[model samples]
Target: MPANNLRRIHSLDGLKLVMVLCIVWWHCMPRVVFGYSLPDLGARCCEVFFLVSGFLEGYRHGLNYKFTFEELWLKAKSKLKRIYPEHAFFLVLSILVGVTSGKEWAVLSDSNVISAICNALLIQAWIPSFAMQFNGLSWFLSSLFFCYLLTPLVAYIALKAKRPVGVWHLLVATMACRVLLEAECAKHPDIYSMVNIHENPLVRLLEYSFAYYLALVYRGRLGADTCSKKVSFLWSVVECVAIGFALYCVVEFNGAWPRWMYTLVFSGVVVIVAGERGILSSLLGCKPMRYLSVYQMQIYISHAVFYSLGWALFPTSSVMAHVSLFVLIVIYCFAVNCLKRIRQNKPKPTVTESFYF
Candidate 1:
């Protein structure tokens, strides 16, 4: 399979929309989606995001495994270009929104000022105390940036592996390490809480690494054979089953399932979704889902800002306010996208010199 085809997987876009919407609802909704309120759907949605991000990064690198310092620098630069501008814009906007609401201390307090610096440098998520401040959702961005920092090394390992199964073995080892760490943390609950373990970028990097290796395996599998109708149908069946299992976990476990199980279930769902040939894929690939997918990041990051506004305006009108805020965010993102397009389309100045002069 060509990289371009992998990139064009419409099912992935639909999946992205699902993840984004789930996160938004989890944050903005008054009540929980599933029967049990223990494990937020939003948390699972983040796992999907992390895995998908790692997979896409690996896919983009294609078969190239060797990385020079220059290549790593380029990769870092590219990721920064994609994320930083919008992130900075929203960071400032969030602060401004707070200040305008007579909450200057939220942005200007000593702790928050320190948090803003950490968030800007993408290190806020690494510290336990600093993890969820500022834009509470922004820790994901910082953690993702950490993954990007390790992309070159991950690519190098994937490229140099003896076989695809080696990548699988690596995933096993990584998970084992994670479990061992959890056990150690369990012994000293006061010192090593879940917040201490889960919130760190270094720990999340282990999860990201698993996803990176999985992408290598997936790409190899994807290229090895063209799925016949029967195989495709079977995979679709698997996809449906995966989704059902996830829902079951949500209800049965009440979000109390082990972390590793959560990772495994969502990773399975992601694989099925990325297969991109199922009936479920066709529905997710629809125009509205795909359109919303284009602004998925915008929706994810900017929703918090408007969330505050929504609650303030409709303190008594929960459902109506939340929905209206969502619509407004979508419109805001659409307008921003349009403006960016127009800016890019504008002609650049040309410089010329007269030979006689």
Candidate 2:
């Protein structure tokens, strides 16, 4: 198979930027979504996120999910390179923000430091203290790291009995689990109760597993990329309409819906549509978008720092503050990119033309 199908698609970069936008909105605006709160959406967005991973991994690794432990570890190293530097930067920054704010730095104690040492490894989400208590954006790092860790195994099972059948099974099992869990929670609906479900390792694993598997079955095997521009364009519009309907159904003027999973279902589908290139290729691949998509993760990490500081300095909520956020983050990104480019131009050891690692 041509690697074009397996390689990371340009549109998916756009999809990630969209995910970050959703995250930022959820973080900044809570009342807009009834009384559910911002953190709720932040956590819930994980549902669609992990599913996208399934889709990408399944697509990237091909029909055969089998890989040696070493192979998995090799991939893990590449992931570490991409994620850890930014994580460390923000981890220290978050602590500085908490400490220098003259607030009681409880998470800075000896015991907490010890715990954070382990958490810095980015392995466990089961620990209560580590949950959004320190290094908030580390949530995505830990989640993606965990997803990368399990890709080989997820791929293996997903590739069996033909790809689609396996993926359909995964999807059915996942939705069924969600339905059952929600039905059981219909009575309690307490934050703690929902937290318990969210913390359940099995649930998180299954959710992310389906994400990677979806990418494999649908984007990979379906050859949605091979579709003509016209059909893909039409499908994109339909996906948007479905997304609009889903939003309308869930986001009532009076209050949020009793079950928010409808948004999850709809958003997940809409996101996949966004990832389809021929559908939105021209726009998503445009220069500005390509630029935005490239540095999006950097923007994500840095934006929070600016927003938190801006909030303290301004000490007021206004539309200009939000607008200023976009301007400041763009300036920060450009400056960082320029610095990186200068570094790339620095002197380095010369190598022969035919040299190989």
Candidate 3:
């Protein structure tokens, strides 16, 4: 199928919104829920975000026959422009919150100054000590920016393969490399800090690259065709099984499995959901879910700030405080989205009007 003719995968948007909420819950209170560790489950959810990002990048690359450095630069710039503004806004907000609340971590020391610099440049994730500086969760954006810059090279290599199996081979090799790194980290826990293993661009990039290759494979095999009734039924079953396997890994395996193993499971979930033929897919892609997804990024980026403020204003252990904080975050995100839309839709002045002004 022609890439230009491909339909939008609305279901992925809904999935993203769901993951954003899970991340918020994890950050607010990292605890076991229904036998699953929220912290570990949150890590898996973050992996899914990386996978979704890479898949979209590869899928967009499929729309073109040629790849060039200029195109790569443009894509990187586009992504940075989209993410950096919000990141900077929240970074400043975090600093203010820290100052007002007299948070020790936000104190201005030499190390902290360096951390601020790194965060400003979106390179905090590359520095283990500085990874959780202002707006700690911004480290995800830092790592994601690194992946965006590499998309051109990754896409070129994947496209050069000329076959889905070849791309799969690349993905397998990357996964093997990730597995070895995970083993090394496991062997020397003292040497590798949590930030080093989790927020390292080099480590996270493997997961992103794996999904990029998987996206190419998906395009080659599925090609955006609408499934017939029988095929849709089969796809629905596959989708359910894929989701079930993912849940099993999160619940049953929990922290026992390697990160790559969970990545593979979540990758299957993404592929199955992207098929858009399943009953679950239809339900997830419903209007309400799609509408809520518009604020997914805003919610993810700003929720930490709200949590910080909530801590200052309310008792940390109070259930009502946590609920109130979550609600306030949602309302703030909604307002932000509304303002963005209004700005985007506002009319531009004509040349004569601008000259008069």
Best by TM-score: 3
Give the CA lDDT, 0 to 100, for residue 69 in model 3: 72
Clashing pairs in 2: 51-211, 53-212, 54-211, 54-212, 54-213, 55-211, 55-212, 55-215
Q: Which stretches of candidate 3 lie over 4 Å from their true place?
A: 30-39, 63-66, 188-195, 226-231, 315-320, 346-357
Tell me how candidate 1 scores on lDDT: 0.71
lDDT of 3 by residue, 1-357 (tens): 665566667678788888988888788875876885454756888899999988866765653635677877777787777888889998999999898888766898988988899999999998888888779999999998899788777877776775767787888888998888888888987877654767899888888888888888887787456432223788889888889878977888877877888888898899888877888888767778777677777788888887887776775566766776788777876576566557668443121110000
Backbone N/Cα/C clashes per model: 0, 8, 0
RMSD of 3: 5.7
Candidate numbers, best TM-score first, in rank order: 3, 1, 2
Cα RMSD of predicted structure 2? 6.1
Q: List lDDT for all candidates, in order.
A: 0.71, 0.58, 0.78
Give the winner by lDDT.
3
Error of 2 at 152 (Å): 0.6
The TM-scores of all predictions, comma-separated, are 0.86, 0.76, 0.88
After superposition, the stretches of candidate 1 with alpha carbons farther than 4 Å from their true spots are 1-7, 32-38, 63-65, 100-107, 193-198, 223-232, 313-320, 346-357
What are the clashing pairs of model 1? none
On lDDT, who's better, 1 or 3?
A: 3
Q: Residue 296's C-alpha lDDT in candidate 1?
A: 76
RMSD in Å for all candidates: 7.0, 6.1, 5.7
